[model samples]
Target chain A: MGASGKRPGGRSARVRDAVRQATLGELAEHGYAGLTVERVAERSGVHKTTVYRRWGSVEGLISDALELARDEPWPIPDTGTIQGDLRGIVQLVRSGFADPELGPVSSAFVAAAVQSPEAARALHEFFVARHDQSAEVVRRAIARGDLPDVVDVREVIRVAVAPVYYRLFVAHEPVTEQDADRAADAALAAARAGVL
Target chain B: MGASGKRPGGRSARVRDAVRQATLGELAEHGYAGLTVERVAERSGVHKTTVYRRWGSVEGLISDALELARDEPWPIPDTGTIQGDLRGIVQLVRSGFADPELGPVSSAFVAAAVQSPEAARALHEFFVARHDQSAEVVRRAIARGDLPDVVDVREVIRVAVAPVYYRLFVAHEPVTEQDADRAADAALAAARAGVL
Candidate 1:
């Protein structure tokens, strides 16, 4: 497993990973309110001062943990077609609904984002980065003339991914692969019609 | 000025409305966690016994307060065409974003909904009722041959409204009338093509 660069040796990397894992575990159990710097230090077998020095605050630790977990997922796929590319992105969105642990943690983060400016910025950055990755595929499709150059790729990306998040967080509907297919198809249709 | 049927034109009706108003004011001032039934009773001119007798718990009081303020705008207009109908719906969605007082109260309820099963159910029912109102407009369009009869109006309604809530609650995006128009257009196109 990949670990931080701040801690140099293999053993140091393992210690950092342990601390990050404990941070996320505490987050899942206690939410934004109950997660404490002291509790994380105790759980990770690291000194309290060391954890505080490395992370600065609970929000910083939470952000890094999310990044580490998120980076393990598959990269945006380039399938040489807009439909295939969108399908890939939808698959990633659907995966969140399938995982119980990730689902609740993500929900808590969303709630926290509403209240905390730092968390809000982090959440926005995370979505913008993910959308940028998927938008690259649409950019390629435009270059190949499969999609119109005038299409707003960001809007197209939003249309494709927003529904999946809506089903998971708002409606609590089953985010099936079929729902993914429908979302992709509608997004492609909207793009072709110059709505995107 | 609409009062509940439970206590009509009696001293009890005046006390109920006073308590409801005070509850909403407290929610605006302190949010859900900080709000208390005793505070509500003190803020209103009602006795603690009356407040306790009417609403058994804090959750019950919150639900009743929200219900008292519940006024979902009418659905898309009967313009004899989907274009005009969608324009009406989008306008309503836009107005919600402009409401400063309503915004925070609505968000607090959404956050509270995560913990209370009854609140979640009430939220679902509120949305379902809104969806049914919007769906009726789409259904009429199908009857008028502006849209296909095979279209699923329920799904189309979801596509139109979900983005508004997603932007409001999750993304914190300003949901302008233009955004609503685009969403309505996209959903209408999908429905016309029998995609939904």
Candidate 2:
């Protein structure tokens, strides 16, 4: 967080937005290793101390940036069936990968989280928030008897997402819409069979 | 490569092993950002040039390390069924996660591959090799009529592995033998349903 570039209505909020944008850019170009508070401050046109005061560490800065980005509208669509909801979630996650900026920033945080317990903790909370929010559509479908109530909804969420993340991190493959549809069908079929 | 604390067979090779080990230790503590070539040289008591000559880059070093680790005996057990081979593959991957040093290094390489194309290439080759190897076991099973000849063994490999990698990276959970068994079951069930 630094000096606001916008006309002052809420100066600090604007500065926060600037800082977040700068952080994402830095991460995309330089990765977690090269991302520094000083660089973020300079890029955001804010004082170095201001960035440090707000974020405390590069990890903290990244976590805040991710939190800010999370506010962007990526709602789970209220599709009538479990398969439909899963397709929507896959599309939403896939969009993150399409962005040259956000994709690497997300990966940077993911990389950082592996070695840092604090980062891991922050990431876990971030995932729980997103998963819980996105899982509502699936829960609704189960409640409406569109899906079997016997299947654990949480497992369904994980099953649907497991492949997307696998492609993202391990397979190094893009999560295509076709892939999402296949995953949705597979997950729903498993759930229907009381396997998921 | 650095100073060898072990029996001297080949000086450079010993130094390389030492440096590699030092790098692994550093990676466990520091992740990619904290790991430095100088530190590896110091830790191993070898010249930095030796490391650079051997690996060229940290990503290269890690790739070699993973490949070396993979060279250790890990076989897909034969129980005269596709399910047995699947279970073996899962267990083998699960065992890799059990290693304190190798596990973090493996995860770090996985996380880094998300950004670096070189790392991604190495990771991709690893997966392709694994899929081919595991699919051979399934192929034999199909020949024996344990599974339908129509099943795509490659997709079965993905299903078997997607869950293991998901647990390791995405879920940040340990992969138990039971979890492996479940994934095997999931793959077989999907294959039987003509989805995989």
Top TM-score: which candidate number? 1
lDDT of 2 at A113: 71
Q: Per-prediction DockQ scores?
A: 0.42, 0.42
lDDT of each: 0.73, 0.74
User: Of the candidates shown, which would achieve the greatest DockQ relative to the real structure?
Assistant: 2
Indicate the residue-level lDDT of B54 in model 2. 77
Query: What digit string (tens of lDDT, one per residue) describes model 2 on residues A71-185?
Result: 6656778767666778788777777766787777787877767655666667766776676777787789878988777766766676666777787789777677777666666
* Per-candidate RMSD, Å: 4.4, 4.8
Residue A182's lDDT in candidate 1: 81
Worst 10 residues of 2 chain B by lDDT: B1-10
Q: Compute the DockQ of candidate 1.
A: 0.42
Q: What are the clashing pairs of model 2? A: B1-B51, B2-B46, B3-B45
Per-residue lDDT tens digits for candidate 2, residues B117-181, read 78787787777667777788878978887778888787777766787787667656667777777
Candidate 1 lDDT for residue A34: 74
Provide a comma-separated list of chain B TM-scores, one per candidate. 0.80, 0.79
The C-alpha local distance difference test score for the whole of candidate 1 amounts to: 0.73
